[model samples]
Target: MKRSDESTYSWLHRLNPDPYSLAVNAALLELVPPGLRLLHYTRTTVPAEHLGAFAFYHRKIGPFHLDGIPEPMQREMMFVIWRIIELGGRVPCAPMGLLMRELAETTQRLKTAGLPFQSLTDRTPAQWKAELSRTWVKRTHAFPNPQTFRTYVSPLDRACKILWFTYDTSPWWQREVWDLTMDPRIPRRTQEPSGQKAIHWHTMEPAWLRHGGMYFVKSMMESSQLAWSTAHGAKNALVQFARFAMARGLTSPRLVQDDRQLRGLMMEFLTELRSTPNYGIRNRDKPRSPASIGQITSTVRAFYAFMHDYGDEAAAALDDDRWDGLSPEYLRFWRPGDIGSSKKEHFDESYLYSDADLAKIKAAAPLLGLPRAEGGFGDPQAMRILLLMMTTGRRINEICMLDARPLTLLEDNLAKLRYQQTKIHDAPDTIFVDQEVIELIQEQQAWLHAHLATIGADADPPYLFVSRHNNLRGQNPYLTHVFRTQLTKLVDRAHLTDAAGDPLDLGKTHRFRHTKATSLFNAGVPLHVVQRYMGHTTPEMTMHYAQTLDSTAKTEFLKYKKITSTATESAVDAEDLYDLMLLDTRTDRVLPNGWCTLPPAKTCEKGNACLTCDLFATDERFLDIHKSELVSLDSLIDQRQEIHRERTGEPMSENHVWLTLRRREQQALSTIVKNLETGGSKPAAALPAPATQAREQAGMLGGQGVRTGHRP
Candidate 1:
């Protein structure tokens, strides 16, 4: 190709082909299978160099590795398209309306597939481009907008226009640009002193950036982009800190707004740094940290980074001393350790709820459509939400993320309160809720439904609690702080105070769990059971609560109390009790290994380990019973196959399950034999005693008068 033609091809390759270059080839080709086969079959090629460059750019733009989208994703997409075509049977039009419908269907298919997708590397870049061209094109515009865009371009515009006005004469991309000058809601442009028109660059507001998972920062620029003027190194760390710590309730977003606290914190963090660290911005190549007074002043320099980058005149205003080297200030906090009036008041609830005060909190966030209930706290979700936490002991995140559906009741008719990973330190992903909590949940769900309906809100986010800050303005989507803000208001109104009647001692989500553990322990329920109910991941954590419970002793005494109360029980003498003596194996009396081989009870006579003595001793036939049970996997497999053959009239393919069971059975037998030797057990009527349990190793029976599976 000629240089000019090759250059044009380069431009075409660099160009995003959607809705324009894609028009060169139709979006769909009839009678072709949906995916890569279709892609490979249709699109044309480019040079290897061009393909490599394109691949590099794709990676640069995204987290794309050469691996592309996964195979399962491709298969899923194919299956969906195949199914859609099989049912509907044709390429619908490719215009804006149909294009949108096709894209939506494709997306829905991808979602239902629930698989990672393949990327450009799966096919050659040239072939990928060709496919993109063919798939995105061939659609007609729904209506001519005269601005040259269609009726339905994505609400997220395809093109990003820089506000730099001097670029008007400079070569710029016009293919994806749209004319938004007609919209009144958008900023109106004016001529600059340079006699040039400038497109406006708007400021980014504070929002909780929602993305999935943890990964390392990409570049200094990306880190800086998180905050308006954060030092590049501080950016990613700050983002991570905000996400992880805020979720943990260790930090709050309010920190960003408090200038004094933030400045002081920055100074304190700087003071901790004795020397320069590798992550620095000035000498990008060198590994060092800033140590001079300017180390703190770096925050000041970053204050206007965004405005400067955007060519905004407001950048000049940032030079003010408010962010300069921190001024001396007092560290007086209301918490006890800090030099302030009161310590952090914990939840005590000593403030007696007046007969009237109880009525107010319950009435604060009232039911929707109830008469004389003015719109104050809005929905009753907040109040009922608090009750659900305190009563049910669910984590705040679990409650916040709960779906709008009624609780899922299982076969036992017990309602389940399964939650995904929540903010609680170690709360389990699923919890089967108590019965009373289920009723509370049902009532809460009803209240939310009515409230959402009145407000014309759909339960889109599946959040149990909604707030003005987090929810859509009207018929929109959710924001992050909605539940956090709502709960704060509820706590303030509820008069939930500390033991000392301290006003600020409101409870958090975790406090409910703490209360539940305390209550359960106090009620004499076993700690292990509570741990299971609470879904503790480890027994160690469970023991912490278990230590508080004296249920075992309390229950024994209670049992005796009942026994004494019943005069009829006196008829059973001590002789009758001797019949039920299983030889108490409580830890104190049981040998170290939980058995008794010594006369009376095993005590280390040598002050040595039990291995030294094997003297024939058994006050037992107690725990060690003559177990002749044979768990034969081969027999089980044969039996299973016979049943299967009889039922299905097909031969058995493999006995993989039986094989695994047989190995496990052998392991269990070995463990049983080993434990017997250690306990010095003299078991009764041993294996091979039963005709059913006889193995080839221990043939029928020996010449002995008694069955001789036991080693005497």
Candidate 2:
């Protein structure tokens, strides 16, 4: 065997005496085709590509001798094998032996059976052509993609030519010489003109081109110096418009000069856009969403308006007033609901992560950065970015674009991150992150520093988020999409769900921002405060992120009405409130001195002395509370009576006011206790208690005819 002590062969030579390496190398040499034998290199350093030669031979080309195969078949097969091996292969030699044996057997059978299309020596021209047609049909049916059937036909014909040469008495037939120099999948040519080509503007009639329509677009591009992407979009839209016009035999700009025709054309284009699928190269059936349709309409409208000013000397023809229905204002039908209406219905509530979902994500967060050997994808940067987005509610691009300098180690275990806001708003530049996020950042910094050293000086970047491998190493990687993909994996692993019982979706990373904002609002943070926290310029924009759930509303409204007569006030316990709202579901409740005016867990906007307002329903349940309050009020009334007795002539109006108010409260408590002791009358409907009404009317009339006596 040929061998050398080169570095490439060192590993092989070290194991030379080993049976497995010797067996593998022997099998590879026998399995590789004769013409392809030059591909194997055992003496010098083999390029990374030669490692995959086994798979290339087995998958793309058979291991048959070059002389055994016809000339045409040999050329095409050799080209495909060379191309695949050049890219690199990963098949082991042992499995390659089995695969190559199978391929060799198959090729032998094909060679034995003559060509699928019989030669002219054994059949007439028509008969031979018919056989060739059937063979083409069979091969086309066997191919995966029907669109590429024509592309594969030539190579298959070349393979069949081998059988023809082996059996037929006639000479090789002349055929079209198709190049097998490059893989068909690699785009070798493009029909699009070099640089940014203008639509067929020059082909229009001289009169129409002279009308300034074409010149208008050219001037706009030159004057505004439109961005490359923007100019590209405008050109594409105009080209599509030209195609539409040409199909209808309205090639000249003059054909659409009439207002009615122009308006009709716009309507037809929009309707077509609404129905058309978003035709990608691979995915041809995905329909354009409402937003996409809206964008097309807006672009078309802008193009017309641009031409109206610069192209048409008579600007009034394409003015907003002239083309009433085709204006951008009419394109607003795409988004549902009016601007001021509640945006709650627009999004799927299940998309937002809940507290339980958050817990699951936290548990799964560590697994994101674990090594692949430990069942992880080994991307700690993705984990750190996702955690930052979830906790900070910052935009994906904003977080990805941050530099190491942006992270500040603040006092009191807090960390502040500062980045310039790109949304062009009045929000602050800083965000306060917690200790957990800080720890993640510090860990990433250490890993990055170490990795940079190992990768060499070229792999060190000032940006915090850098790609770890390939051409992207040491660059601002813009890992927002990577963060999203890893986040989805974590979500699936955690099995998170929404309130609606649907599995949560992590596709829209913005949901994390909205989730954080909504949580802050539900925590009773003021709207303006939440706006600042989320770095939103306006309260309206911040409100868009907050959700109004029934549970949150019930909890906050209950706090507003938790009043007491004592100096210290108390609110219902959360468990009690939940039980009252869900488990019990009863409408009746007894207050300290009167009935509760509110429904079970429902809010009362007017929160004051419960005895005064209507809707109070009391029974034996409140007996002890009412009796205790009655005794206290009675003692206070007697003191007021003593003070009134010392006043000259008549008691002061203020003293009468005090006596009347105390007496009313005392009566309410006594009635409640009496009803309880006697096993109660039928429970009262939610109406005003008697004494509360009398005291309120007297006080309203400047305490006129107020009673100073303690009748109760």
Candidate 3:
């Protein structure tokens, strides 16, 4: 063989003179790029090279023996090395030779023993597990440390998956099953290794329907109309519809173009959805919940609507003209009333943690980060994230995706925290946090810095709460599943129980949001303010989180007596008023400054004239407002009188419509102030009659003809 200094592989000719070794070396060199061949074959110590393209450093290779290894094992080791180099992966070289030798020897032995194992990629997960057990049992010395074996096998598993799934070259939408992890559009912060990330489109029948479904889902994701999880759900719902359609031989969209046929088909699908068990492995035998049925129907309806609205685009994108078969009937295939309401009449308050329960949980919070040997789950990040959720009422993803410098300091130990509102688009993301929260954040930052330092990372990580392991430069945030697991352990350790004495379920971290919102609402925080704090786009969403406590409602209602427009206390008892108005369940009766005493069945004759109406009532809580209104009324009357004097030689007549109305309003306000100031204990006879009543009596007697009675 000839040697050339220009080629990095020239030194490979010096390793072994055999043709097989040279051929294997040449193939390995071809697999690796010239830029990555930074060292020669004779060099045992690998030099550190910073690969700017990959944004990572190729660290020094560990010591390993290459002599006396079989040629096939040698080729496998070289392939592993070149593969890691090609993919820009970081796998230490020392274990590469040993692991490759073990695998090669195992394969030969398995083949000789007629086990029929060709390669790792060909083995099922169960078969692979059995092979690993057999390998460990046969050669315990080769893998003394289980962790070392895991470390060596991890990269090989990834390589096999990439080969088997074609994850590198194939587009996710082109495959029958789309893995969210392979989709670049998905936000990395929300990605997880576990859970239902794979969306199976192969289950949908008929090639056209399947293709159209894929196009619809991809378009929805691309347009940001739905999240990845929501789109996955939509796909699942479409699969159900497809199954029904296929079974009935209605495979083509054109077959259901008629309104009556489509309606009938949808009705049948709804019936099947209601009767059939859930599609997944977990709840395969259980009947679908009403909420699930509603969601399925709604999603299917949305899919058809999308098809109808974007038929031309779908036809162009899918390269098929059949998409034009969708007619106007597809847009209205399911009526609004066809989908039953999924909302329950009674809310389950068990999800909320009361003050007592919170105290118990807080007392047990210290057990979260403790080591397993110390009788606690070793997860400090979970504890910190939990505390943040408890204080800020942020969504779990928001808390998990917090930036390294999320806090902005204001004056006087107050700070504002910014979080990523992952669920809602264009929602407010900042909330004022107190010193306690600030301190917790600072502590977390310090811990993260120290952790990064220990891992030889020089810069700050992108996220505040980072994953514990396999996080290159702490790029990935802590997984929500880990937090949930830690919380479950904490609940078990604390022996916490719900009101019903069952084991408390802290699995739903969102309950923290509900608990905080309810606490604020019951503490008299305004709904709009809570809405902003909770990062909700609407008050209705915030209200869903706030469950008003009965005690708080009754206490707030009975805080003061309800006085009538005549400055006399109402004849109805406070408790009776509470029941008659149903203040606990109704919000329409609540006024800005007081409560309206009008019965629900009766309509108000005086619209904005509440001050002069007999049905109006107020308490000391609105005393300041009444006084301010009185001052404004007096100023208005003086201004009008001055204008009248300017226009006429004499002051305006006392019976003038405007003057009479102002005086009546003044009398009502003054009477209310006096009643509120005197503790509202005076009898009705103690206060004089309102000016409106006197004017009404005068009008009835043909004096000035001023009409002061309620409108008929």
Candidate 4:
């Protein structure tokens, strides 16, 4: 082959065929018995390297993956397909749909008719064969000839029955039979049922099934691009709504078609939900919390809205003309006041870890990986998760879902954690983590490698925290329940509790996040710094996590109160004094006699000669401070006066300018002392400088405008 052809062939070869793909080919081929010819199928690919690759058959819904179908299921489905093709029976247009509907109706009839119901279990082989033939001919009208009936229909019916029996009483088996029989041409990735299995449409009342409960789930999951969990929840919620309707004798969708009727139903459901006890026996006596009630109601409201938008198909199928009057606007106006805030505030100190509690946790962390013989039944994964939680302040899911590949260790032991944000899908790609967190992750890496080795080299664990259990191998550690259980044990073993003597509530792993964020905040970490550390997109979220401590609040309040009370005066209130204190020129420039009331913009002409100025006003608050400064000034003046006497050889006061300055300061200090002795009743009151005494003396002596600039 040419190089171009080879490249095309390689691309074609990469298109790994699944059972459904094989089954679709088998159905399409009009060849002879067993139709093994389809098994020799090859893909056709484009030659261009830039264009990537394409295949001959992509399923209707979306393109299938290389290993979309599990090997075991693929083999079983292929065998069924081959056998059908060998029987020379033409494939039906909607093969799976017809087969499942026929099987469902047949099963329903068999139960209704009350045939020798135990005949299959008790009867002879011939009798069983006869019964199978009778049921196939009676129920399924697809069989073309008698030969095909015996060869094709009889065996297909038997296989369906056997599958139903083998799975015991699972209603999903009916769908399973359909799945096996059909080509499953949907070109999408395999969607597994997450959380709980969806309630089968057969179990629900006819109204729900007809009015788009199951159809909605299938459409949203397959076509509308809803996630498996979301689709599953909607399906479950609709099922519960159906059950509620059935109990109230409101079997059909039309009964609650209007907004008013639907709202009434919604109110009734919510009221009953509020009174209903929790599911688990431990909390069985306790009524469902407001948050839980809100979720249930919201789910139902969502269902109603969905039905309103797409219920046209369902309404058209309705036998009654009232559907024309039915507004697809059910529960649009129904308001259930904010359910998220119904519980206690998120900022509870009881949930946070104290220094002592943290120390206990730190000690207990290592005990998780100890052998069971040494009284440790905990997984190392749990310990690592807790460590990450305490240090990173990230949500448990965010840490759990962290990709092993994105744990990049840079120089200086700094590391970056790259992850797809689980809560808000469009959040940042990476957040910087501390070295200690990187170390814990490194330990997890070692554990993961060892785990994969034990599980065999073919096994892949995508996440940082992976389960090593036989059943949940290669999956995330069961943090939802298992991790919490382990943490609770650690808490109990460590005897960790609060100042209130209450045992630590490991109930919320989120407490670790709050504790970490609050700790950073309490340590005076900047809001932006805490935000980045906690992987919060906004500082507000980090602030929310940083719950205020009552002790911190009280201490800060007392400090503020003391400042205010000391500054308050009978003439000037605390607010006025506070404003005055904020003025730029209200500093230590004032003389010991009084504080300077100089405007900040003005330059003082008498810079160092503040003692002679009248712009000064003294407050008792700074009296001691001023007295200390005065003592230092007097000591400096004596030293300068001695130097003046040695240099000039004359009385220092009469000859030196420095002695004159010291005398002026001494005079101001004496006036302050005398005023303080007389005005001892007032505390922290501003007093004028005694430059006024000199001004009074000058006025009496000269009787001219005493050019002293003294306000006093």
Candidate 5:
């Protein structure tokens, strides 16, 4: 082959003539640009500096000593070098370096054993390692260290598997293995916890059923009907169904064509799922939980529903007519009662970290990123990510995927942080953060800049917490599992425990979000405000995280005593009233400045007239609020009177219906404020006569007299 003039290997007028060298040159010509190859080199020597300039250079591997090695070994080395270059196209740089080193070592070992180099297809990793070890001992009269030998062989084995395996990029519906990571339509957030990315339809028993399932999953993805995580879960549940189908000899979709048989099959599957040992690694020997079984049954039902709805399209996609057997009745394979309810009777607060535990976690958080030599976890980025989570209450992925410059200072000098709302599409992506959070983020930015500089990476990184290894451009964010692993180490090192005194499961990094939400809500933050701050699409989602703190609840409830419109304390016992009204659980009874005093069973006849109503009550806790409202009301009344008088060309009537109601409300507020100012006293002048009190009670109860019993 003619070499280009700019090619680094152009100086080689005559090649080694060996097939390996010729093959290496040919492969390099295609794989690498001509300008990148060694242009000036002597036959006897290949310089290390020249090799260092190549894209596939291994930092640890030095110059080739061609004169010292035999011809055969040199040819073998060249062949392996070409293979390394090919593998590097698929793997990242850091891992590629290790793989190259291992392959180079293996080449040397093979040269020593006087054995021809063989591909993984001809010899398995174990077989090659065993042969190498036996040959080394026979020739040297000693054994190689077991650990060192395993290390030498491990990377080669991994590299071989990667090189030999071809990733399927065909139309998703046509492939048995759906590699979600390669699918651009799928968001990275939905492919979480790292490492597990592919959905293996081939693992499901019965080929025909597998194709039908694949069609369902593909349609779901194409239409954005399900997230990658949810789709993966559905795939898992279908695998369970496939297993049951195989066991019952229902190998084809046609086997259960009848709706009755399908229903029976589902019932049998549910029974088997309830009784069978879990196939999952975590709880392998235990029976699945009701929630787990329910999820499986629901997924299977959904799969059937999809098949029934898209029977024609699925049949065409799979090129199989069997999918036509699916009927609308198959959609109702399981009834609502058959599905187990997974709702908890009470919310579990065990996930929320206590103030004391939080302080402990904060104190020990630095150890997460400390060097291993310093008895730390040696993952500083994880420590920063943890601190960000603690302060900003961001989801782990949001923090991980933060831009290098995420903070923008507002007019008030406070900073607003911008993060990707990965879970909720098009949700609010920016949140107001305090100075502490701003400083933490800035510190992280500075650390990342310095780290990239040290590693000779891209100066302007895309992510705040860039992946530490295998990412030369600083393009990808740190993996969520990496941060969790470091956090788990910190928990163990600090002896962190949950409320139950069990070792804390920092694996649920989301507990930080729950802790922050509950703290803010308990500190009197409004539900709508908290929802916006947490980037929740609905107040319901915010409430899920904001469990009421018992201490806060008690403190707030006992902060005031209920006083009536006459400024006298209510006759009902406070504790009895609290229970009778179900104030703790009833949201409607809650008001801005106070709570409604109406009996739980009664309906108020007058609306927005709480101030003059006998059943309306408040206390000193709302003194300032009432004062503000009274001033505003007085101003409003004055403005309205002026407007009416100007329009009618005379003073507005004091007996005007609106004026009368306003004056009554003003009198009631004035009495309440004066009483509260005097520490819950009844003003002698404000106290009403027995007939007036009876009339007020009659008006409040819609003409019904006060009952002769304990007030609710």
Candidate 6:
């Protein structure tokens, strides 16, 4: 037995690792394969990574025997290490710990065999080749991730010291080799790495650690996320938020997610959901998807509260601690996977029309038996409904809920539209109608009056924006289903499109509201002004009206913010943004050589200045303004890709889509952490257990608009 306690065995434990001439290193010129099929480590971190003597040095060479590493692999490995050094790992993934495990096991086996091997050092190059040919090599292909295996390395620390190398040559084939080497010798001039040599890695940074409770919290939350509440709905929301989060290039946001914090939050919510008295929930009568119910309510409420804090003073005023330490009993749950009991028959967007599309539709109404805007006032009435949407930007439901009888036009042309409906239904929000919108409403009323005699003025629906029931009013009703039917007929008959004949998007009626918000801002109206136009009692709801159109709208939108532009090619320079972020990079974070490509490089493949690169970096500005804090942005990108893979199961494209996807992912993760801290996840041990966590992991994000994805 290789006595672990003996001081001489210290090197064996650290470098050699195995006594069996295991595949990692070797004993008597033999390799150790994955022979311990039954053994498992408890409470042990995988691969013994991220700790102890290895933390500072953090990399290793081998008890290096040359068998497992094929000859072709060496050169390639060297080259990769060189690039890793140059790139500072902006490349994202460098699964080093996994690679080192393969090296360690192979080395241990070869060493334990204790065989006297031919010395390649003394032999001629041909002799070395001959001996290599004569030697028997047993190929045991490594695990996909060789780093998962772990050993009881120590009492306080179980992480193993993994090797890392930066080499040059074929980056593809020698990826494993480079993953194993120390840092290569970097040349000073352009800061390139030396060829074919491996030195110790000097990252001089701490390895990412989410230990013990932290790891457990992540595991539990991730596991339960999709299963809780509405699984599928949450999944979609997660995708949206995750994409955004990954694009946000900051580590500070990541620190907020710690283990104990979230575990406690989750535990509390789950416990409360199944509390002894059920927290006075009235609708516990209906069957529910147990896995998601508890966590989803917890998560959403937590997020709403968190966001409410970040909102303006008015929002803060509405926030209530009255339900202090009280878990919100679930009121309603949209079934997971499917978007409720019915399909998307009524929620279709056809009732919505853009301003231009509505104009075209209005023009065509005369041909379809609907009155033209000029004569009988049939099409004109429809026009009034559209103008209302454009002015108020109210959702289709909100618009339908309005009873115009309560609205009175003042001499100033201001329409005082009052209604007691669900605008933050928990509280009362007064609606203020703008003047231009009031005029449109008056036009709609005149059209209605003309049509009222034909359709029976007293027969229209209670809702102001009645759809299929078009002119049916006073007592008769029009449900959303009517809107769908009428909308389908209108779209089919109108044949609306842009002048180029590209079919205009007309399915969404709510878009009139979106259009109102978007158009008002594009016309140089302030967001707050757009907000009042929408009748949002609070600024938070008002902000939702904000948007930037692709190109034209952006140029015009800036004017509202009082930001003047000279029509320069750059609307907002990407380099300028990077410089601001890099203005204060993390302490001791290392940056790569091409930190800013503008300083000029020694004539390589694509040596154009950063601004001209496909992604377009103003490299000179990046260096000049942010040279003091050039962090290797590799990790952020890596985390982004990884989360993307986890959520969408699709790799991102190379274009700026990568940035878009990453930013969302990072934000979702940030939201999760915040919910964990103030919401639940803490005191996880005390909570009443709910369904499995796997559901919540996949399906908890977005609010009432989102769907939950979990099922039995």
lDDT of each: 0.35, 0.47, 0.65, 0.50, 0.63, 0.34
lDDT of 3: 0.65
* RMSD (Cα, Å) of model 3: 13.6
Among residues 3 or more apart in sequence or in different chains, the pairs in candidate 3 whose N, CA or C atoms overlap within 3 Å are none
Q: What is the TM-score of candidate 4?
A: 0.52
Residues 151-229 of candidate 3: C-alpha lDDT, one tens digit per residue: 5454444434333332123445656656543344443333333223567666568777788888888878777777766
Model 1 / residue 247 / CA error / Å: 29
lDDT of 6 at 590: 12
Q: Over the stretch 624-690, how does candidate 6's per-residue lDDT look in tens digits?
A: 2122211212355665668778988987555656465434433433332333233323232222111
lDDT of 2 by residue, 1-712 (tens): 0111122122222222121222222333343455555423222323343432442343423223333333333343344444334322122333333323333343454456763411112332233334444444555554234443332232233222322222222211111111112112211111111112223333333323222333444444445434322444554455545555656667444346554455566667666665666644444678766655555555555655555444434334323233223333333332343112322354644455767777767677778888989988788888787788788888776677666556787786797888646453346878777787788778877877776666442344656766553312354344455677777887677666655566667777788887888778756578888888788787777766554443344433333223222211224443354345334344233233333434555766534444433444343433454555566556655656666678665554644765656655566556556645664343342222213434333222112222211111
**lDDT value, candidate 2, whole model:** 0.47
Q: Give the backbone clash total of model 6.
A: 136
lDDT of 1 by residue, 1-712 (tens): 1123222223333444221222211222332242322212111332321121111222222111111233433333233233323222221112223223433443344546683323211232234333333334544434334332232222101111111111122222122121222112212111101111212111111222111001111122234232112222333333333433344343322234454565455444434332334334544445333333233334223432322233222212232222223222222211232222222223332222322333443454343223425545554555566666666666665565565553688855487776534332345656677676787777866666665665444454345444432132122112224445655665575554443465532334465566566556656567567776667877776665444332322222222211111111233333332222224442222221112233335444533222122321112121232122222323454676687789889866655564454444444434443444454444342211111222223422222211212221
Model 6 spans > 4 angstroms off: 1-383, 419-423, 426-440, 443-473, 498-502, 547-712
RMSD of each: 27.1, 17.9, 13.6, 17.8, 12.9, 37.8
User: All candidates' TM-scores?
Assistant: 0.31, 0.46, 0.64, 0.52, 0.64, 0.30
Candidate 6 overall lDDT versus native: 0.34
- Over 4 Å off in model 5, which ranges? 1-149, 165-201, 255-257, 283-287, 369-378, 497-503, 546-576, 579-712
Q: For candidate 3, which ten residues in a row score worst on lDDT?
A: 1-10
The clash tally of candidate 4 reads: 9
Q: Weakest 10 consecutive residues, lDDT, candidate 2?
A: 171-180
Pick by lDDT: which candidate is best? 3
- lDDT minimum window of 10 residues, candidate 5: 8-17
